[model samples]
Target: MERPTRIGVQLAPQHAPMQATIDAARRLEDMGVDAVFGWDHFFPLSGDPEGVHFESTTQLAAWAVATERVQIGPLVFCNSYRNPDLLADVARTIDHISGGRFVFGIGSGWFERDYIDYGYDFGTVGTRLDALAEALPRIRARWDQLNPPPLGRMPILIGGKGERKTLPLVARHGDIWHSFVGPDELSQKLDVLRGHCEAIGRDVAEIEISNGASVRDGIGGVGFERLDALHAAGTRLLTIPLSGDDGPDGYALDRVPAFLEWRDRKNG
Candidate 1:
């Protein structure tokens, strides 16, 4: 059966107070978004480099308690930030906290400033991907051994577009594969991912395809036309980012109702 289309809003944690970020998550949930996300980074990814930011997992835990229906997670947790075993335990705890509403979205670390500021090794891209590859299995193993297992089978969402190493890792482990590419690039990448899945004897369709939509350029900013194109290209999950800097009332959700309407129309 074809999966229903889903919409998510990423409440970017940069330049916002913790309360504002929490409020944004709650509001997104109220707006009928399928999931709410924050990014794992110590500093801002845009605008002022020295903007206010909160820790990702900690904020996610807060959101887990603040909202009842929405799935919560970091858009992609930096694998290099915490020990893999510890990370699994953290995810498990949050899973229980949210009553099985946590999605474990992770990726190989990027952003040199985060590593240097936090004292983690800012190694080469190859090294980071290797570390992520090694860490994923250990995380799963630790989850298996934890005294109280996760409240449910936690879905693992891997974000990246590297065909050689990343796609293979996704084929082996990911429940969802996320990327920030347009339709043409997404089509090519999906083909590559399918090859990896075939090589591993896994069904490519088992992994949900997720893509990031720019609020300033895609569906939210442009119209439903871009969304229709993405839907036809096999994307099941579409995520739009909301920055904290947008307003004092929290992230601007003016575009969400329309997006939700579009989602319902598409799914129906």
Candidate 2:
């Protein structure tokens, strides 16, 4: 059966005070978005790479209590930032607080500054993927080893677009595969994912396909026709990342209206 479309918003944890960030999350929830996410990093990705930013897990733990209805998580937690077993426990605790509304989004580490400044080993891409590959099973095992386990199974969302390592990991382990790609590119990668799934004897449909939408003119640029194509092609969860700076007038929150409208129509 086809799943209903869902919209998620990443509040972009950059250049904002904690209170403002919390308020933004609450507002996004009240506006009827399905999930709220923030990226996992010690520094801002844009503006200044060394600029002030909030860490994903800490921010998410606060967000768990700040909003009751919104499902919250990191867009993708860097696996190198914390030990796998410890990360699983942290996610479990947050899941309990959120009443099982936490999606454990995780990925192999990127960003050399985050690693070097934080005193983590800055390894090669192959080595990092290798680490992630080793860590996944251990994280799952540790979850089971915990006294109560997770609030639920704690759906795993794996983010990345690497065909060689990341997509295979998604095929084998992820409940949702989140990535950003243009429509044609996404279509092509879906084919790659299918090949990965087939090699592993796993059904590709078992994993929810998620894509990022670029919001413009208070609406997503791809429009309803493109959205339909995505849905028909197995993209179940679509998210738009709204930065405070993405607007013409600065700090515009109007994107949510068009996003919600599209989500409603697609789900209907």
Candidate 3:
């Protein structure tokens, strides 16, 4: 059976105050978004480079208990930031806090500023991906060894667009694969992912395909027009970001209700 199309909101954890972000999260859940996400980065990706920002896992714990019914996670946690075993434990704890409503989104480290400011090695792409590959097995091992285990199977969402390292990792471990690629690229990537899955005797369909969507008012450039082709190419999930920078009032969620309604229309 095909998975129902789902809508998620990525609250970028930038520009706004922490309280505002949390409040926005609760509001989004009430407004019927299926999932809520935060990006893992030390500083703001937009607005003032030194603008207000919060750590992903520390805040994800708070978000877990703040909103009922919405799956909560980082859009993609950087693998280089923490020890794999500790990361697994943290994810498990948040999973327990949410009563099993957690989706673990992770990816190889990127953003040179994050690494430099935080004093981690800013390695080459190959090295970072290799670290991620080594870390995945350790995370799985740590999860198995946790006292309570995770409250559920704990879906892992892997984000990256590379066909070489990223797609193969998605084939082996990811429950969801997220990327910014539109329909055309996604179709080609699916072929690569299928080849990887075939090598392992796994079914490519077992991994949920995901992409970003633009707001109705053109707040984001993720291209809502391509949504149909994206879905036709096998994307089952879409996420839109809400930023305070969208306007002066706050995180501009005024447009999100319509987007959620669109999700309903698609599901129907």
Candidate 4:
């Protein structure tokens, strides 16, 4: 079955007060966004490196309590940061808190600075991917073993563009696949992902495709032309990242209504 077109706002929890981050999530939910996301990192990914930042999972828990609707999760949690079993328990707790509105988005660890500063081993990409591969099944197993399981079958979102290791993992486990590439690149990656699905005897179409909107351009400037291409390329979930510089009012979400109109038109 085809998934409905959905829009998500990633309120990046960097260079902003914790209250602002929480407020932005509420506002995004009010604006009718399907999901709200925060990044998994100790420090800012852009701008001043040592800027104000909130931890992703904790912020997600806060968002669960603060918002009545809108799914919440990290854009992609670093698998290396926590034990898989513990992460599963944390995810389950949040799922219950949200009444089943949580998406578990995870990835192989990147950003060497996060690992180094947080005292984790800054391993090679291969090693990190290996760790992620090991973690997914363990997380699933732990979820089953929990006293109270998640409210529903929790959706797993895997973010990356690796054709070899990552796509295969997505084929086996991912309910949603997120990538930061344009239409042509996404189409190419989709083809590669399909091959991986074929290898595993899984249906590629079962995974929803999610793409990131350019933060530099803002959602309005991305234009319907680009959105059309992305929709054609199999992207049903479009996510825009709001930076801390969007001002103290929180997340300059004026463009969201237009995006919603576009999504409605496309989905229709």
| TM-score on alpha carbons, each prediction | 0.97, 0.92, 0.96, 0.96
Error of 3 at 27 (Å): 0.5
What's model 4's TM-score?
0.96
Error of 3 at 111 (Å): 0.7
Model 3 TM: 0.96
| Candidate 3 ranges beyond 4 A from true positions | 216-223
Answer with 1 or 4, whichever has the higher TM-score.
1
Tens-place lDDT digits, model 4, residues 112-213: 999988999988999999999999999999999998999979999999989989999999999999998898798889999999999989989999999987
RMSD of each: 1.4, 2.2, 1.8, 1.5
TM-score, candidate 2, is 0.92
Model 3, span 146-234: residue lDDT tens: 99999979999999989889999999999999999978888999999999999999999899998888665333665455777888899
Off by over 4 Å in 2: 217-229, 244-251
Instruction: Locate the minimum summed-lDDT window of 10 residues in model 2.
Output: 214-223
RMSD of 4: 1.5
Each prediction's Cα lDDT score? 0.90, 0.84, 0.90, 0.89
Decreasing lDDT order of the candidates: 1, 3, 4, 2
Shift in Å, residue 250, candidate 2 = 7.4
Question: How much RMSD separates candidate 3 from the native structure?
Answer: 1.8
Clashes of each: 0, 0, 0, 0
Q: Give candidate 1's error at residue 248 in angstroms.
A: 5.1
